[model samples]
Target: MFLKQIVHFSKKSIRLSYQFQTMSTFTSRTNIVTGNNEWIFVDNDNFDYQQELARSAFADMLHDHERNIQYEKAIIKTLQNLSKSMKKIHILDIGTGTGLLSMMAARALNQINNTSCSSRITACEVFQPMAKIAKKCIEKNDLSDCIRVIDKRSTELDLENDLQGDRINVIIAEVFDTELIGEGALRTFSEACKHLTIDNENLHIIPARATIYIQLVESSVLQEFHTLKNISQQNQRINIPNDCRHLAGNTIFDLNLNELKDSIRPLTKPIPIFHFNFKHINEMNNFTEEKILENIQCNYDGRIDAFIMWWNLDMDEQGEIQLGTIPVWCYDDQEKIKNIQWREHWIHGIYYPQESKIVKAKDQVSLYCFHDEYSLYFDVGTSPFPPRSFIPAILSRSAMAAFNSDKRRNKYIKVLEKSFSNSSIKRCLYFGDGLLLPLLILEIYPNIELIILQSSNTHLNHCLEAILLNSTIKLNYQIISSLDKNEIDFQTIDMILSEPFFTKSILPWDNLHYYYLIQKYRSYFRSNIKIFPQKARIRCLALEFNNLHKIRSPVKQCCQFDLTPFDEQIMKASLNVDETIEPQSLFEYSSKKPTLSSIIDLIEIDFEKNFYDKIEKKNLEILFIENGICNGIAFWIDYELNENIWLTTGIENENDSWINYSKQGVHLLPKPIYVQSGMKLQISTGFDFKQGQFLFDIIY
Candidate 1:
């Protein structure tokens, strides 16, 4: 047995707690030991160590001052309501993450000290590390006697042993996930009502009730995450089947929807679909399935691409101190909305249908919301409503809209049109997965011989469908099975066109797939053969990100709590992985002027030349122009379409139309580096076409 001890300091004295751990009890050799607490897991790979840190919870919950203030007010009200009774109160704080709520409850008890009531809080946490930290935090707040930290999940707690056979009178829990019931709140509530709570009418739940609100809205901005739209090939639209247009996917979106209200167009009024009564035992114990059917009348004529959903919490019994997660535009009182502080802990949910719904003004549409034990699903109907059942619908939607993006489609049209219209280009060969360009090119130049080589069957099928749909146009074309250099007649072929992409892409440079193809066919090409992108270059620069780095690199401490364990986990998990750079509007999360030297070119490649053989590997050193914490590097590809026309996925001071259309790449550092002006930073960069990977190492 291995013994570890934890020492906690208070204003008056220091207290120590010890726990014994046996190696046999652990499923794995690796365990995080912090003070006297050991966090054991089956395998390190199965756990998100950063998520299990107390600092993460502190950073999220502390920054949400609005949530903190509301909870404080609600706690006061709860204490006031409990003061009316003369009985002693036993409170159970389920999922007492950092013991913040338990501390708040203990503080509220101070105000009602003369109520002739004595109160005690039993705070429960599943993670041993967090529970130990919570215990220390409780002691630091000088509330150790009032609140006892139990290192166990609420479900695992026994009434006879853990609670000393006494049932709880007041229950306070913050077990809700992005989706209100995602963290098994329903099960927790059901079990608590059945076993842990007292059989009395005076039982009080801090949050009396919760209601979910939803509205149908149309937004091109929101659609960027769902389906890819085809509106670039001479104003052509991709036709989707009507049967595939109903509820497609349900996902919890945790962003500030209030900021996106300007881009959103509401099609229907907001409606309350689901309600959960936490205070009523019978209400919770008997609850199984929740279903809602309503005749929703459309107020606007538009395509309903998605549903915007949020929730409201009734904090007290009277519902005077209510907490809401509605977007700013949803509120009628604009002044009040502006005055009310926003919260990050709770955000809105966005759901996209399988197919977009087209509705006109005053159309009576049937809206249905159904839920089982853990999740919610929504649907729509007309005059004839469908019978509801417990059967689960496939509520999953694809987030990849690469094939559907209008901007991408437009770029392809411009490139293909340039290739087809040039009289010098008689014979052309294309190598790309995007089928739209080839079909569009064939429509324009019917006499030119076009050879296409696609490896993906899905891309080929899509092309076949487009060819069938556009049967009116005929073309001279041949699609070879492979991109074999021997099959192509280089002497006659005047041009080569490609979108430069592959299925296995995580970073922006993965599109170097185009360079690899060009290199493979370079020896067989004619001297005069033209390439669409005359040149391609990789640009890199240092950036001082605001909070964006936190997603990849864990902070050492948040709100004065130690997060070294989390930092270690993040560094281990993130090493050697080619991270996917999410398309972020950096204006929101990154500082533009980290240094005066902005976006310096790192490497350039000529598409027409065999540059892959003579690879450029450099150990470049750059100096900082200003003093700031350099968290990471941002890079993007600059493709020279022609001499004057260039396509770049980099930062630009452009309008929403341009920014939304472009994509930039990023790589977060292991930790932030505070550099002063003239500080030299060394970066080792290399790209191997054979391996199809870009290597970058930052050396300070």
Candidate 2:
């Protein structure tokens, strides 16, 4: 119990707590696939990730296959009408893989037993093994009478004068990746259309136009390998710089090919394909390749469900022989035709985007071309071109925009377009504490080239826990120790931490492993209290109150404090120090094996924790007996304080009589111990005494 005073000061440390409460449960699912180098496909048990790979071209190719039977039927219906008198027809199958579509068309023509028109199917394949297999399939289906397979690429079509009937009337090929860039489709189709088609006849292009979409992903792969730089000091050590690459897994770029499809848009369009005055031919060029763009726009705006390019061919009113895109039309429900056997053409792509906007030209976004292993069948040797330099300024801006205001201010970032750098530079630096992820913007200030965080090992695991709990930008840590010199590389950084700074502040208190530190700094602020007094007849401590408690005048001689009889009673009652046991004792650290050396650390921290918890404080005056005994007083400091209780040393010598001095007034701040003597001593309070119940103790 005590009287108190209030003081003012600047600065305060406020602790606020927040938790990211999420309700989630865990369940395990299994996915397994097995195939030889010849073929590869993920078994059904797993989730489909085809679009995630190579622009989902594999899905597009697969779709072509699933539609093979229907395609054959469509063309057969047209063929049946064409020749009541033609007698026979010959078809050229280019880029024939697995013979799915070629075989289907062959059987359809053969099934009708046409005396008026006989048909022959010639399959041309680039890959030798696939051609050999298609040859066997012709024999297996008893279509050898009508179908003959050529073990040559489609580009070699111009050389072959053997189309069963001298000149082929129909051409079929399934070759379009999502970007329409894979499988050399352009070279094959151009040559076939030019050299083989009959005069004024149309050419068939299967799965013709492919629409591409670019997206961003949250992949751990890129982050770990992108930035590379090191920092160090001149004090004799070396450091290594390392980086990683990862994906954010979000779509930032989308492009459409509807115009490109309605008319043929070749990577490099040739004005004339042979001298043939093909019936209807319209096309466009100068469109983009598989190239990805960050901000994009087109003349028209649509969601771009997927690119659709079908057949446009020349046939008489009788539906006479002609060629064009595959007979199977594009299917909106891509998954319904999953099996490949009846497919008229292989499907390759499916860009089912999330949160995608139907953007027109000049819309800012992020995009990347990726290979998705999640597609049902893996490509034999397919991957993607190294991505063009990209950035996710949109995502970053969005995360920032969430704070303070719900409205996003992304319009300003558009200045990046006209003033963008044309030079392709990739200078990188990857040195930031995982503990401070959020401090990235303030500290980095757009300086880093790239940051790749290691997913399981470095980033998610090694992150500091305190930062995770207390702050959003916990990782923007400050340097407690500055470098003496800046030129030294930090790849092999090995610097000793400063003594008091490393000990009392840098490391968190609760979970530290400092048994050795306790040994090393036995004399400095230790971690526990082995050398401290368990029970002292006399003790002295000082504590500050203005910062927290607003307490003052702990000395018994402070006349400035007005203590009524009621206040005096409380102080005397509070003097029993046994009840003031701290919630956590220095001995509790003993169980954790804290040594005498580490025990001293408690002194400094206890000073901060208990500064003005109580109203009274003290100063060490002296230690003597009631009989006037004395020597050089000695005791140990259990904790540090600016104004606190003072415990006296047990009396050593004595001559007799004693007098009580606190009789003048009750102590409030910095309790001073004085042996009673003839000299008149009064325990008056110090400055800043306010009226209140800051009751404290002056224990014997």
Candidate 3:
């Protein structure tokens, strides 16, 4: 519970007080005040309130025990090595999120010699809100005397004033994202080496060196996310021209390595592409350097769909202590993937090429890797180009790729083919975001009259472009923003075709935009008008996925760190917001672990009936089909193209028709529960009419 008190002093002064309820889960103190305005009227210089109440991101970091354990071991090793030197150890810990490393260093030094108080640590946290928490953590661990929390980014720290004119002997920093250098680590290291850390032989960096590796793989499953696909065994009747070239690249693709290990097939062995040696300051140039790996022979005969990448860290000087992010299948011991030591902070990376490259056994290719300050780009070719500054290509290759997907084109072809079979439906009206439907309709029915209603002039121009480029058939179509009832005749329109999609659709239910339009235009259509999709339904099922729950809630602790504080902070920040439930492709994340319940229908929408009416709340009782741990609920939409033809976005079966082009959405339970066979689970679900969103509630 949270309570606020407003105390009004004279008209010019005010004091606002906030009291946050104590979290018993972690034994946090009661009546904790995160922010108060009492000091504002007195002195604001020393007044610092917690600015970042959201702690999910931080909780995620603390959940990685592999990272925490390795850092502890590294810190211990560094302190043991420094003990041999007569000079006192001055450690500079940068980007200390929880002051875990500083506390570890202090604990290690204290264990070695209780009488010696020479070693000191200065932990720097750029987020002042987080810095205060780091200070609390240090004090909680009884190491406040040895480690001092500095509320400033490393770059902002003045060496002379902040460090008391002292050069540091050791530097420990945790500041790398999935892209490795995405967090501006290059600049941080470049400056720290120049001004902060001593350039002496005794200086030691916790992570001595790091190396990035990449391999080519053939994965149609992975390509489905980046490019278009056609999965039917039969030949497609309609073909969208594919002419887009790879334009650019972005941050690394972080995923559950264990889930994708068996899904991807490799064409080449993992190759080391870049290495950064933190001990040697000059190695920082790897961020801006351009390099080429030439004549790499392909080991397998297959088409290379993507480049999978991972990096390993050498934590100690002897390289005896190291941390690797390689997936379980990559290791000799497959059990490692199931091990908790496999961390989440750093997962594998994937770089998708503009087009799939066909490679035969013994075939050789060259890979060119270029980088600017904070990102890496890869280009595959037969030879290397001269080193030059990186320039991002400006193109709509992604949009073109989406348009060229086979599965999507197949849906359009099947729908139009099935609808055209009705002899009475001659003229068609298209209402959608693009003109792809207009072009395709004209291709099949060359003599059919098509009228497209596009709201944006920009989209209308695109339609003209598609028509201009593919002029095989002269289309009888008119583009209009809206139908003026006074000036237009609606009697001739006998058919309506739509994708039932909207640009504002972030959630699956947002597709109601199409239904809302139909509700508004139902009276304008002829009595016998036929809609493309006859009906739509919502279906759901209870599932168990251990890895999926880890993203929503932490099941592992980082060493001896009390991560509950961070978890509590995050839960409070997200009290009113539904951040845990999200849209995901169940096809990519299915478990051999048995499901608790089969698919259950939660709601149904029959386009034949009135759908614009207020949605009535639904209460469902689902019996367990099998005994298993139920972690969440998976839901999807089913669109009935015709009476006999159906396209679904739900969980796909190996034997089912491979025409599901839509991704399913998931709603994770607040906590996982083990249900026995025949047990009934109660759930209530409905639509938030005002917010245009879906609401789900699980009752025990």
The prediction achieving the highest TM-score against the true structure is 3
TM-score of 3: 0.82
lDDT of 1 by residue, 164-252 (tens): 98789888887775568778887787778778888747777878788888899989777765553333345243332333222223444
Residue 309 accuracy (lDDT) in model 3: 77
Worst 10 residues of 1 by lDDT: 27-36
Q: lDDT values of the candidates?
A: 0.64, 0.30, 0.65
Clashes of 2: 138
lDDT of model 2, residue 602:
14
Sorted on lDDT, best first, the list reads 3, 1, 2
- The per-residue C-alpha lDDT of model 1 at residue 383 equals 35
Q: Name the weakest run of 10 consecutive residues (lDDT summed) in model 3.
A: 27-36
Across 250-363, the per-residue lDDT of candidate 2 in tens digits comes to: 222111222122222111111111111122222233111232333323334333222222232232223333323321223245463232132112222223222223543333
lDDT, residue 494, model 2 = 18
